[model samples]
Target: MMERPVRKHVRLKHYDYNQNGGYFITICTRGRIPLFREGDRLSAAGMIARACAEEISNHFPEIVVDLYCIMPDHVHFLFMAVGTPYMASVRSNPTISKVVQQYKAAVSRRIGRPVWQRSFYDHIIRNPTDLEETRRYIAQNPLKRMNSNG
Candidate 1:
C-alpha cells in the first residue's frame, strides 16, 4: 500500500508532545513499502532517510539529538522537548506533529516529491530503563537495516 507523499488531507490528531518526557517515534512513507529497503543494501532512499535522521541535529538550534535512525521506509527518534517547542501543544497537539510535518516538508523539498506518510506514530518515554532501551534500538536500527542476520 504505497502512494506519493500525501497532502495534508487527513485532519491532524491530538498529541501530547511536550511535558518533560522522552519520546520514541516512528514515521513511515506513504503506505508501508520499503522506501527504505533496497536490495541487501541501502538505497539512495536511505540517504533521504539519513536526511531525516540528521534533522534534529540540523534543525532549529534548539532541537536536540537524543537518538534516531532512518530506515528506507521509516524513521525513529528518541527526542525530548528541550527548551521551548517548535509549536505549542494543542488538544490534538501539533508539537511532535510539527516535527513530523517539518520532516515531510524537508524530504519533499529535497526529493521533489512527498516522501512521508500523512501521519506518524509516537510514544512518550515512560522511564529511564525504557529510555535507554529505546535509544539502543534507534542506534542499532542502521545495523539491522544493513544486516539481515543482525
Candidate 2:
C-alpha cells in the first residue's frame, strides 16, 4: 500500500492554546464530502456531530459554544475559553486542541467511523471586532453555500 504524505502542522508554535480567548474553528469532512444534509434537515451523522459540539459545555466548563454553523461538508464554530482564576479548575482544563479532539472523537464514535479530516482550521479572535466578523462569516456560510450552488 502507498503511504500517505505527512501533513504540515498549521497551528501556531509557541502559542498557549489553553489561555483565555475566543477561537474560530472550521472542521471539514474527510475528502470534503457533503454528509451532513438530508433534504432540508440534518442527517443522522450531522445530528451526532451537532450533539457532540453541544456536549463540549458539559465536558469543559470553561469553554462556551457560540455562533456555529454546520455546512454540508464542514462545520464552523466559535469557542470562548473563560480562563479566569475563579473559573480555573482541574476538571475544566482543556486546550483548543483537546476540545476539538473530544468533539471529533465523540462524533466518530457515534457514527461508527471517522468522518473528519486529519486536522482542523482555526483563527484566534484578537478583539471584539474580530469576533463579530468571524461570527458574521460563520452565520452567513449557509447562504454563501446556497448561492454558490445556485
Candidate 3:
C-alpha cells in the first residue's frame, strides 16, 4: 500500500473564517498554466471561472465580491463578508475557502478537466490600508505581465 503524503496547513489557526471581514485570495491554475489569455481574448475555461467568481454573491448572500483580476495563470480577488442575522443562525455559513472551492469546481466541471491547484493563497484584510494595497496589486497584475511580455 502506498502512503499518502500529508499536506501543509495553509489556514490561520484559531481564526474564525465565518467572521465578517475582508479576504484577498489567489487561485492558481494547475501547475500555474497560462490558461487565461491576455487583453480581451480570454479562454473558454477562463470565462467559466469568471462567471463562477461573479455568481458567488448570488449563492452566498453574506459574501460580496469586490475587486477581481483574472490573469493568465492565476486569478486574484477581494471579497468581504457582511454577516447578517440569517448568516449567524446558519451553522454552516459559507466561508472564503468554501466559496473558492465552489468556484474552482464550477470551472472544472464546465471545462471537463481539473483547473486548480490543491489550495489557494489568502490574506485577511486587517485595515483599509491593507485592502487598498491588495486592490492595487490585483489591478496592476495584468499591466505588469503586459509590460514584461513586450
Candidate 4:
C-alpha cells in the first residue's frame, strides 16, 4: 500500500488567533483557476468575492479589513483584530479561522459554487515594518500579476 504525503501544518501552535493583532491572509481559488480576473478588470465572481470580503467587517465587528486585492486566482488582505483578550473571551470573539471560513462561504453562496481551496495562508504581523510591507504587497498584487502575464 502506498502512503500519502504528510500535509505541513501552516499555523502557529499554542498561539491565540483571536488575540488583538494584525494578520495578512491569502485565500486562493481551487485549482488555481483565474475565476476572479478578466484582463485588467475583475469578473462578476471577483466582484462578489470582493464584496463578501468587505462585508466581513460588518459581520465581525472586532475585525477591520485594512487592505485587499482580488487577483486572478487569489485574494490577499490585511485585517486587524482590535478586540482585547478579555473582551474576546467575554464576547466569544471569532477567530481568524472562523472569519476566513465565513468569508469563503459567503463568496461561494453568492457565486453559486465553491471557489476556495481547503485552507488559507496567514502571517501574523509582528511589527510596523511587516504591516507596511504587507499593505504594499496587497496593493501591488494585481499589478504584479498583470506584469507577469504580459
TM-score of each: 0.70, 0.90, 0.89, 0.93
Model 2: colliding residue pairs:
none
Candidate ordering by TM-score (highest first): 4, 2, 3, 1
| Rank list by lDDT | 4, 2, 3, 1
Candidate 3 structure quality by residue, lDDT tens digits, 1-150: 999999999999888887788999999988999897656578887788788888989988888988889898899989988865244456555778888888888889988989889999989999999999998998888888889878
The C-alpha RMSD of each candidate to the native structure, in angstroms, is 6.0, 2.4, 2.3, 1.6
Better of 2 and 3 by lDDT: 2
Clashing pairs in 3: none
Look at candidate 1 and give me any clashing residue pairs: 14-92, 15-93, 35-72, 36-72, 36-73
Residue 80 in candidate 4 has what lDDT?
Answer: 93
Given candidate 1, what's the lDDT at residue 123?
75
Give the worst 10-residue stretch by lDDT in candidate 2: 84-93
What does candidate 4 score on TM? Answer: 0.93
Query: All candidates' lDDT scores?
Result: 0.68, 0.87, 0.86, 0.90
Q: What is the Cα-based TM-score of model 3? A: 0.89
- On residues 20-132, what C-alpha lDDT tens digit does candidate 1 reach at each position? 45768898888766776576565777776666668654664444668777676787887776655334473322366676678778777777777777677777778889888
Give Cα distance to truth, residue 75, candidate 3, Å. Answer: 0.7
lDDT of 2 by residue, 1-150 (tens): 999998898899988888888999999999999898876578988898888888888988889998788888889989999855334354444889999998988988999998999889999999999999998999888888788878
1 or 4, which is superior by lDDT?
4
Best-matching candidate per TM-score: 4
User: What value of lDDT does candidate 1 attain over all alpha carbons?
Assistant: 0.68
